[model samples]
Target: MTKAHFDDLKALVVDDNAHMRELLHALLNVLGIREVVEAADGEAGYAALAQYQPDFILTDLAMQPVDGIEFTRRVRLSPDTPNPFVPIIMVSGHTERNRVEAARDAGVTEMLAKPITTQSLFARIAEIVEHPRAFVRCDSYFGPDRRRRHGDSHSGPWLRFDDSAPDVVTI
Candidate 1:
């Protein structure tokens, strides 16, 4: 991406750890994102959104009062918030299958594991800018389209007792 792509873009970095927040600040700065807002926890992040909306959000999954999932939920579902469709990247050291799934279900645009590299970090940001997902609102979901691709199997095809997979259309 060009400097024009990220220059002057506002971003929020929410993490309880001071070092992580600083590290994110540096990463965002390298991307030419000068306006980086920070919060110690999800509640502060929510309040910051009200005070001023950012183009994107980078939040931790675990925190006191409110976690990243709850923060994302509010942004996607709460009427008190200004925008429900902000691009959010959930960052955490936890890269387990369950944690990643939780991040996806929480409406995050992307999930980045901790100790983020320059290349991976930029790649994630670039993906967000280049490919934006359309928002979806349903009784059980209200956020970006959860499906990443037409053929992505969020849940594996149905299996019979004989272990034969069902012919299921992914899309």
Candidate 2:
């Protein structure tokens, strides 16, 4: 799926800041996404997601009532949503390892920093559409495959054997 073919795709922008929401709404328009829904927080975002079956979701990490992580968890784990496998891209100013890990654990498909660029935004969109990650389901987790790299099974110092794959670890 290319940008040219995304004119009909809808994107839901969830941000608590008015300015950031406006900025992201404009950027999505510039990206040829005409059908867009905006939300002030994760609670509103969840409502919007249920109201509008968007092709993808762009959300902020920190929010009141319902944060991005919680919203994503609901979207991925909730059985009442319109679609549980909808793509979600988390946008936040805090890019710390813990934040990123939390977002990933909550079922985010991608992470974008606060000051987003048109190129970077488009790249993430393209990556999600062009090279979508496979869906994974476990007893306590459900979302895109967590591992970004794969290779032959091996145990050595060069290859970190202790990883997400081949283990029953908590996300």
Candidate 3:
């Protein structure tokens, strides 16, 4: 039997390496997902999330400036804006037990070893998107259809949309 597909959802693939991003982007498209966005690094990932609010996020752990771990922490802890608790699948070359443990502790929904295959990626995506709260706390965070709550703190990562402070929005 074939599994149910969520063809309407959008996804963000974050990685500094151009080839990796391209690979994942292609894989996602092959999965019957058409709306896939790309981010060069954690900063770009956050920006894409704020602007697009993709249904899911696939990010690489190792990157310059703000790494995946830090990015996850900031996304989880940020206040003001309601976060979607989006499922964040973090990928890395370090597959040691301790490293995997660390990634889990840092708030990643799932961890995958490098040299990602289509089977593994699709399987994990199915698992994650199937569960209502697979990666994030959806009710607490906002999605495309979800409405924004009053008093929701938007003062965290993703973007610096400070109600009090002003900053530039860059690509």
Which ranges in model 1 have alpha carbons more than 4 Å from their true place?
1-5, 151-171
TM-score of 2: 0.86
lDDT by residue for model 2 (74-113), tens: 9999888777888999989999999899999989999989
Q: Give the backbone clash total of model 2.
A: 0
The alpha-carbon lDDT assigned to residue 2 of candidate 2 equals: 34
lDDT of each: 0.85, 0.88, 0.72
Best by TM-score: 2
Number of the top lDDT candidate: 2
Residue range 22-71, candidate 3, lDDT tens digits:
99998888877899999988887888888887888899988888788777
Question: Candidate 1 at 159: error in angstroms?
Answer: 19
- Model 3: lDDT of residue 108: 75
lDDT of 1 by residue, 1-171 (tens): 223655868899999999999998998997678899999999999999888678889999999989999999889888787788889999888899998887788788898888888788788888888998988788877889875654434344533243344476988
Better of 1 and 2 by TM-score: 2
